[model samples]
Each structure stands twice: as structure tokens, then as C-alpha cells.
Target: MERAYKYELLDKYIDQELSDKERQELDALMTEDEEFKEEVEVAVMMNASFNVEQKQRWAKLLEAEATKTSVQPSQPTKTSETDTDQKETKVRQLQPRTRWLRIAAMLLPAVFALFLYLFLANSSQTAPQMADHYLSNRHQAPTITMSQGNDLSQNWKTAIKAYQEEKYESAANLLEPLTNSTNATAEQHFYLGLTYLYKEKAEPVKAIQQFEKSQQLNPAQYSAEGNWYIALAHLKNDDWTKAKPLLEQIVANKDWKWQTAKEILEEQE
Candidate 1:
């Protein structure tokens, strides 16, 4: 748990058991310490090689073992001697090929754990520089207004006008009450979400909740469009996990601007 490497942490790392905080700390160490960085790089390479070879070897050994077991003579004969020899032969493959390699083997798990743990953590981090690059540009406030309905709907008209004018806080306040009303529409929830998602003083978590509610309120009309807003909200928050599924969903459905969603997903890698 300390900044220095511990065999226990290494064991967990190799076993894919490190906590998120521990993994991030290891990533920071790699950036700050050259010696540690080199050790991790070497360990990662060696462990990857070992795992591949070990899997292949185990596969072949199991196949041969199964064949031998199946083709046994009808006579009830036990070959403890043959079994022992076979085990010894197979185990010999796991032994280090050289003295230096043997010494490194003891420490490799720690370094490799650090390397692998950080790699996994990297998979879910934010890419702020790319978040708004294209998706944000493509967005525009709705041209049509829903002002023809009752008094609750009339507030949405005011909210939309406030939003288009970039009066985000006022727009958000105006729309918030509308969502709690029995007369609330999916379109109303969606507009409130946009107000919260304004780049200036953005509240991305609130934005996501609103967008998801919009979807639940009217799936037929808002499934694709609501998912799109939620994805944008996640991007604004620099949350890869929340954004990626929506991006993939959009791409799979060939939704509006699906090509751009694919590009964003690729860049995340």
C-alpha cells in the first residue's frame, strides 16, 4: 500500500486484484521514477511472454494427458511411476532457463502487476481534449418550441428561449420545476439536461440523470437522442465508462452522426 513496491501488491496486481487507488498510484510511480518504469516495462514484456507460452504448453500437456487416460489397456493396471515421471517432465518447463532469469522471476510478478494494473486503469480514464471536439460542435438548441400546451408547457417555452440565449442558470431553474410536474414531457426533461450540461458551470451528473429520465419517459422518441445527450454529459465529465457504451450503441444502430461516435471510441484507446 505504500509508495515502495511490496510483493503482496505485486501478487494482487498479477492476479488482477489491485484496488483502483492502488493502480493509480502505481501509474503515477511509473511516470515519476525511471528505474521503476524500466523495471515495470521489462516485467510486463516477460510476463506476457511467459503467460502465452505457459497457456500453449498447458493446452498441449492436457491434450496428451487426456489421450493417455482414454487409451488405457482393459487390464486394471496403475502406473504411479509413469504418472510421477510425466508430472516431473511437465513441471520442468516451469523452471527458469537461467540463473539471472530465476532471480528476476521472483521480482517480476510485482513489476508486471504494476504494469498490468496501470494498463487496466488507463482503459476508463477521461479524454477531455477530445470530449467536445466534434460532438459539441454538432449540437444546436431545438428550432421548434412546445409553447402551444398548458401552463406547465409554457414554462418550457421560457426555458428553451433562455437556453438558446445562453442564460443557462435561469433556464435550468425554470425547467427544474417542470420535470417534477405530472404534466412533464420527455422533451422537458431533455431541455433541463441541456441546461445543466452547459460548458460554463456544467453539472454533468445532473445532466446524465435528466437525459436518462428523458429516455425512460419516452423510449420510442428519445432512445437514440437521449443516449446521445447522456454520452455527451459523460464526455463533459471525462468519464470513459459511462460514455463508451452509449457511443457503441449509437454506432451499432447507425444513428445520426454514428460515424463521429465511432471516431470518439477509437480515440479513447
Candidate 2:
């Protein structure tokens, strides 16, 4: 009976919706059953990995909806306690093992994307459509329109303009060519990583790759940023063990990114 009960809690455990008592029960089961513990770990990883693409897709859907309703779009208005209670009741009636936790976790990346889009849109009123299209297509921005003899500052200005217009791909493409120049510095790689990070919703794999490249190219100051991206990649890939170390490094860093890194680490806990 205890063995059967432990199996029953698998879904809840994966979704992280188990009550304190139920969790305690699961701990006891795992202590006595190594196989059961491994099974639960696999299930949790599977759940996180399977849900990654779905979460990104939902973020795109929300982006499309927001674009369509551009003028003061109806936001995900904060829910009241009564509404939450009602939803919880409905959820219990329908979902076999609680799905709210999955949905909530899925919202994190989407919220980040939304905020990024809003920031870019507000800054690029002159080319709103281009910005929106770029974001929607998840393409990188083209490099600066530099005719020969353009100064470094001028090139960076162009890159910043592209970034402000939310042409992350273009910004990245522009910065990519510069990284090969003898004068290129760590800041360039860091900015390139920033471009990839912005497009995380559309091309997470690419983002991870670029972030890794940034770390390799500039380890002095961008190591923390690289580690943060690594953690996010691990989170997206459902490789908790792989992510934990990188997240720990970022959390320990006394940098501005630490606050956000700490928050994410806490969530995983």
C-alpha cells in the first residue's frame, strides 16, 4: 500500500503541488526505495523538459495577442483571492494531478519576454512594425549600415539602435563581425550574449550557444553572465543538476544580476 501510494504521488511531485504532508510521505518512500527515487527524478526532469517548448509557444501566442491589441492591451490582470479560489476548485475537478504549478512556472519566461518587448517597443516608436515583425519572426538583426571608414563608436551606435528597435538578431549579427576585429573587446561578446538572451523565446538553443560563446570569449567579467545563461539553459533543458552549479555561482556573485539569479535559485529550491 505504501509503495502504491508513493507511485500515486509521482504526478503531484513532478508538478510540485504536493502538500507538505504528502511530500514528507514521499521523502520516506524515497529513503526506503532507491528505484522509486530515481523514477521520481526522471519524471520531474521529463515534465520540465517536455514543458519547455510548450511554454515558449505560449509566450509567442501571448506576444501575438499583445501585438494585435497594441493599444493598451488587456493585460493578465492580477487575480483576486476569490477568483484564485474558484480556479483552484475548477482545477481540482478537472486535472488529475494539479497543473497549476506547471502553468505558473511556464509564466516566468513569458513574463520576461513580455517585459523585454514592452521596453523595446516603447523605445522604437519610429519602427514599431519592424520591431514587432523581428520579434515575431525571432530573427537576428542585420549588422550596422556602415559604409567603409565608420568609426567603432558609430558602429556601436548603430548596434544600439538596432537593439532599441528590438532587432536582436541584427544586433547580434552586427556584433558578430566585430568580434573578429583586433580591437574587439569583452563588452562586444557580452552585448552579443545580450542579443541572444533577448531572443531566448524564439531560439533557446541558439541563445545557449551564443551565451556559451560569450563566456568563452570574455571570461573576465562576463563569467557571471555566462553562468546565468547556463543556468537558464539547464532550467529550460530540465537538467537541474547541471543548472544548480551555475546558478550557485551567479547567486554568490555580488553583481547586479545576483538579485535575479538568487530569485531563480530560490524558485528551484
Candidate 3:
């Protein structure tokens, strides 16, 4: 039952249906259970190995079956006192399992795919699509609050709030003033870069400049994340050549997103 529950969690996760609490529980499992992590990685790659057309076909079938089972009442299975009827029942039981075996036959040799199959299927798809998916799912901006009393400016607080609220233009305007302040730090420029990258009709060029400036000001603190955003910025501009090397660097240096970068680079190739 415990094992079945774990597989249920994986299915919900791959389906993007995991609640926040369940996601945290799964994260703990991944960190503590190597076997489960490996299973998840392979399952993701198998799902991603489907071609675009095949993915859509399978997705529709899966969704339909799931809905049917969930919303419709289950019909009772009647056992007959006949050999022919028993044979039919046995075949019915094996049919779904056989179908799954056929699906697994398409597995790629790789263990993991970047987007849990959301962005793979056709790895050559547009870079901006990939970048947008990654930014939406993978990026997390640190929360800044004045309660800790770390000398944070009001401007920084408001700008981050705007950023969190997805009001990128307001965030950019608020962050601009912070960047001009006497005590401006790398973090301020870093967030401003993020705003420029995400604001309506995004300015990737300006975003790249701000990320670079932030890295130059404090390489030790900002270099890892700075390079990550720069890579995505290049991707947003459809410059795979630029993004490729930065992702490679991330993998080489074992940054926090190294595994994600490695998988993204692998998918493109």
C-alpha cells in the first residue's frame, strides 16, 4: 500500500496535480530515497520520448480514462461458472497491463527530461517556449521582508512585492529607483534584470545588461544566478548558442540548477 501510494504521488506530480503539501512530501522522498528518484527520472524520460503527435493521442486517452473512472460508478464484475468466461476475464485484466508495456517500449536511454514532458516530445521546439516554461516552473525569487531589519530599503520591499504580484512593469519602475539609490546592491540590479526580462514586450537585451552588471559587482555572490538568467535571456531571444555554454557551465560547476540545466541541454541535443 505504501508503494502504491508513492506511485500515486508520482502520477499526480507528473500530471501537475500535486498539492503544495504533497509536493513538499515528494521532495523529501526524492532527497531521502534514491531508488524512488531514479524511478521518477526514468518515468519522466519515457513520457518525454513520445513524439508530439503520439503525446497528444496518449494524453487524450489517459485523460478520458481517468475522467471515466473518477466520475462514473464502477460496474460490478460478474464471475461466471464457465471456463470460457474465466478466460475472457483473465484477458480483460491483462489488457491494460499489456498496453502499459507497449508504452514503455518507447523509452529513451536517457533517465530524465527537463519539463516532465511538458516541453520535450520535440526538443527542437522554439527556445522561447522552453525558456518561458522554465522561468514559470523553475525560478523562485527570494522573499525580502523588513521584519528581519537587515537594512532593506522600502523601495526594495515594494519592488519585490510588485514582482511577486506579476506586475512586472511596476516592479521595473520601483526597482529602477532602488538601483539609483546610494546603497544599491547586486540584488537590486539582479531583480531589475528579472523585471526587464518578464515585463510586457520583454526587453531581453536590457535584462542581459543588468544581469551582467550584477555579476560584475559581486561575482562570488551573484555569478551563479546571474549566469542562469543570462542563459534564459539568450534563450528568450532564441540564441541557443549563447544559452548552451552557460548551461554547460552550470553543470560543470554543479550549481543549484545543474541537474535541470543538464537535462535542458540534453533535450536540445
Candidate 4:
């Protein structure tokens, strides 16, 4: 029953009719449950389809009303027997046309609604594929540089090599211990976070934690990249609310990733 209730809440959410507490509950579920998130996505698409259908129906109704008004017999110019005969003939001629118009007006909305539903259903099926492609294409490993006295250890070089070779799990294992060391730098934490993002089974929330730590430790050096990765982490989880502010900040700063961030924001909108 609770599950059924949550499903019903999706409709209220799409309609923007949920109360504050209910909205919070739904948000939590979406964050924690992938299935719930997909359900919400479907609900949103269906709501868009219904909105289109309603608009089409209204347009058809208005057209039908306009046709009816236009076809109303004009006031008789003169009340004479010959004029009466001509007016009767005109009404007879219009009756069949008006009937056909009314029938078309009633049928068109149903036809449009069916088409919209099929189109939206197909789009929903393809959305996940599109998201996967975008993520895979956009998330390239960033290059790293070290100062003369601050050269990275052999382990760090090996980790970097592993990451470049697409062995993200191996890279993450090597970097994990480095992040916990007292001498760990912001760069170390940033790359560790990125490995989590690139791994076959990503851990986005974990990536966000590490990226936040990296930003805090060396805001001057890693701030822009940190913000970009954090936004990507949230995006990976389908948490647009958290990602949007970060993307907006990147765009406003005209940062290195500003163009990509702007494109993402536009797509979301």
C-alpha cells in the first residue's frame, strides 16, 4: 500500500501539487532509489504528453466554435417570400458541411493524443541510452602537473598510468591510501575522486565527498575543476537540483569547462 501511495504521489509531483513534506519525501526516494527515479521520469513525460493533448483539444474546440459562428445565417436583408426560399436553401447546403466539421473536431484530438503518447513513450526509452553516451564521452581524465620539489611518488605515477589505461579500479585502489596520508595534496584527492567517477560501476556520492575535500584544501588551484567534477557527480546520480547551481557558477565564471557546463544547463532546461 505504501508503494502504491508513492506511485500516486508521482502524479502530484508532475502537476506541482505536492505539499512541502510530501515533496521532500518524494525527493528522498528519488535520490535513494533508481527505480523511483525512472518512475518519476516516466510520470514527467506522460504529463508533457497530456498537456499537449489538452492544448490540441482546446484548439480544435475553438476552431469548431468559430466555424459554427461563421456559418450562422446572417440577419435576413428583407423579409420576402423569395428571400425566405433562398435562405432555406443556404441552410440546407450548410447542414452537411457543419456536421462533418463537428465530427472532425471531435476526432482530431484523439488522433493527436495517440500520436503524442507513442512519441513520448519512445523518447523515454531512449533517454537512458543518451545519458550513458553523454557521460562516457564527456568524462575524460584530466592531465596533472607537479612542481620541481613536489614531484609525485612512484605509486602516484603508476596510478595515473593505470587510469590512463582505463583501469579505474586499479587506479582507485592505489590512490585511496594516498588520500588518507597526512602529506596528501589537493591533486591527490581530485584524481582519486575522478577515478571513482570513471570506474565501471561509478560511485558518484563518494566522488562528491572527495572533490569537496579537494576544493577545501586548495581552492586556489583546484576550485574550478573541483566544482566541475562535483557537478558531474550530481549529474551522474540524476540530481539536477544540486548540479544546476554548480553548472551555473561555472558558466558565470567562464571557467575552462564553461561551454560544456552551459550546454548541459541548456539541455536540462
Candidate 5:
């Protein structure tokens, strides 16, 4: 009946007073009547007695949709905040590792360079070949050869014999001419000094001069004997200050001369 007379039920539908069967019939009529559906929908909205549950449900749905729409803008902002926090944490975590790696990178090269410099310096300073060369040069014997003759110079032989007999002045007189010769060897200076020592004339100073000459010719040759005799000469002259180093060298030799040199050194001390 409501569908046959749809306009008659409009008031009752707006008032929300239609029976369940009549409401079903009116809904079916409204589906086919576009103008009538619009009229009824407007009237029901204006009516004070519209369906309370439907109004409440529609208000709740609208509020939920508003909340969803409002929250959409904030979602991106929240994502950005989370991303920023994660980035900050990552930067913080990486900073110390980066700093330490930079420091290590800087220091590693310096340490390696320093080590290399030291190694090269030591290698240059202490080269085995250089050391051997220096030792060979320092210990080399002097180029002074004795001339062999069937008729030996009687003056030289007489001086040598006088030295063997401990006749120091006679030997010195004979040896002086040979020492004055430009061709004189270090051995001539040594024998001349021994003559002066035994004669007790210019003992320490003469011995010191001859020892220094021997060292200049050959650092290794007669060094122990020369040093010992120099110390003995200085001791005889009572020059303790000059004698000490030579005496010390003589004592360190650990040879047969050491005992005699030590005894002389003790007497001076």
C-alpha cells in the first residue's frame, strides 16, 4: 500500500513512525522514485523524530573518518622523526670509529717512516764492509823495510850493540844521526827514545814523542810496548797526570809487560 501511494507515507517515514512492513515497502518505492527519495531524505533529516540509532551511528562514522583524515598528515611527520632519530644514532655510533680510524691512518705512516729512517741510519752507520775497511786501515803495518847488506854499517851495528849492552849515551850518539835522516823509519824513533830512557836524559818527553810517531806510522805495531815505555818514562820524570792513561793502557794489555808496568804504576800512585 505504501509503495502504491508513496507520497502518503513520506510524512510517516519522516516522523519515523512507519511500521516495519510499511518501512520495507517505502524503501522499495524510494529505490524507483529518485525525486521522492530525495524529498523523504531531506524531510527525515529536518524532522526531530528521525531514527536515533542511525543518526548516532552516522555521527560516529563521520568522527572516525575525520580522525583518520587528520591523522594522515601526522604519519609522514612521525616517519620523518623516526628517520631523523635513526640517522642521528647512526652518525653518533660512526663518529668515534671514524675518528679512531683517521688517527690510525695518520699515525701509521709516521711510525713506519720513523722506523724506516732509523733502520736506514743504522745500516749506513754500521755497515759491515765499512767497519772492516776501517779496521784494516787502522791496524795496517808501516812501509819501513830494513836494508840487508853484507857489509853492515859499523856505526848502526855499534849503536845496536851499545843498546843491547845498556850503554844508553853511546847508543844515543850513534842513533841520533840515523833519526835525523829524512828516510828514518818509526823504528829509528823508537830506538832513539829507548836510548834516551836508559840514559835518563829527556826520558818521558822523548818516549812520548817516539810513541806518538809509532802510532802515526802503524796504530797496531809496537803500541803496547810504546805505551808501556811512555808510562815508564813519565813515571821516572814524576809526571803522574801524563802517565795515567798510558799506564792504564799498558795494564789492560794482559801481556808480560803488564806486571812490570803495573808495579811502576803503583809506585807512582
Candidate 6:
């Protein structure tokens, strides 16, 4: 059934055995589905734990072999030629087993090292890939709400309608005037920033500036959201250093967005 196929795909993903196409599909699902994302996280953690356990098991086996090899029989101070020959024969008989053990010990460490290198490489790639997905999904226009009797202009209303309709160019053009106006509200500035992000010819740097202005105008209302978007903008621009501090702040605050921020930070590490 379809459900069984999905489970099998997930198993392949966790084992790092998925083909490129399958991996891409899974990555897309992870971005869109929170439960699926959490499942993948758990799977990765379990896989890493399993690898560690196997490494420990191999280490113990190697140690036991080493201890066995070290325990040689004591030789007599005065031994007959026949006794020496007998000892030599015994040593020859053990050499093959000892050589095989040494080979196994060397191969096991190499195998562990290879696994470690692959895990680290894969982990490093996961964060940047997730960031890309986050940015792509985040470009959708945000819902706009207004209070009754507010001073919002007709142009602002039109801009919101345009954004909702995915007419990002028109939305950006309409919001531009409000952004430049002296009496612009923090909400206007924030929406303008979102418009820039959604526009076809995206202006992420401009978006960042507008978001920053919004935060300055009304930190109490816009600070947390502003910080989150600014960090996302930096990520979209591939400026991880700039994004890191903002994500850390979100994580420290333990806000609603903290879980996602923490995941991004973990990927970066």
C-alpha cells in the first residue's frame, strides 16, 4: 500500500540508503510537514546512536583480542632443543590467528573512521539545505489584519489584496510609498519587507532593512518577528555568521519559533 511504501522510503532515508530523487522528495516533505520532520530527526539520532554502539562493540572486541595476544606463556630458563622446537611449533601455529586478528583490528578502525567522516559531512549539508527550504516556503505573503477606525490608507488595503493574490510586484510597488513616507507605521514597514521578499526579483537586502526599521519603530510589537525574518534573510543570502546570533537569541528566548531556530542552529553546527 501507499502507506507501506512511505515507511519503506523513510527507512531508506534514515539508513542513508535513499537515492538522490528519494532524498529530495523526503527533504521537501520534511519542510512542509512538521511531524515528518520530527520523525526524520528522531531517525537520524537513532542511527547515530546505533553507529556509536557498534563502534564501542568493535572496540571491546579489539581490546579482548589484544589482551589475549599479550598473554604469552613463560619460557623455561634452561630448555632442551626438543622443548625449544616444541615452543617454536606452538608459536607458528598461533601466528595465523594472530595475523587475522591484527587485520580485523586495523580494518574495524578504518571502517569506524569512514562512518564518522560520512556522518559529519552529511550533517553539515543538512543545515544549509534546510535553510534553503525554509527560505523558499517563507516567501509566501503573510496575512494582514487591521483594526477598525485605523488610519490605514486605501493603497495599503490594495497592497494587501495584491499580496494575497500573489501579485508580488504590484504589492511591492504599492507598499513602497508607505515605506518611504514619514508617517509609516511599523506594520507598514513590516509588510513592505515581506513584499520585497515575495516579489519575483527578490530584494532580500532591502527586506532586511525594512524589517530592521520596523523593529526600531516598535520593538515591543515587532522585535521578535523582525529578528526571526532578519535571520531568515541572512540565511537566504547565505550569510550564516549574521544569521547565527539572531537564531541564538530566538532559541534563548524560547519563543514559539525557537524550535525551528534551534533546528537551524543544530544543522549549522
Specify the highest-lDDT model's number.
3
| Model 5 poorest 10 in a row by lDDT | 133-142
RMSD of each: 18.7, 20.0, 12.9, 19.5, 53.4, 14.7
Query: What is the C-alpha RMSD, rounded to one decimal, of candidate 6?
Result: 14.7
Candidate 4 residue lDDT tens string, 116-153:
44322223423223234345653455565656325668
Please provide TM-scores, in order, for all candidate models, with all chains considered together. Answer: 0.49, 0.39, 0.56, 0.49, 0.41, 0.50
Judged by TM-score, which candidate is best? 3
| lDDT of candidate 6 over 3-41, digit per residue (tens) | 666567788987779999998888888889899788878
Regions of candidate 1 where Cα sits further than 4 Å from its true position: 1-126, 143-153
lDDT, candidate 4, at 228? 82
lDDT of each: 0.70, 0.62, 0.77, 0.76, 0.61, 0.75
The runs of at least 3 residues in candidate 4 whose Cα sits more than 4 Å from the true structure, single-residue gaps closed, are: 1-151
State residue 109's C-alpha deviation in candidate 2, in Å.
19
For candidate 1, give the lDDT.
0.70
lDDT of 5: 0.61
Local lDDT at 264 for model 6: 77
What are the runs in model 5 whose C-alpha is more than 4 Å off? 1-152, 200-202, 253-256, 266-269
Better of 3 and 6 by lDDT: 3
Count residue pairs with overlapping backbones in model 1.
0
Error of 5 at 2 (Å): 99
Candidate 6, superposed: residue stretches over 4 Å from native: 1-129, 136-151
lDDT score, residue 65, model 4? 62
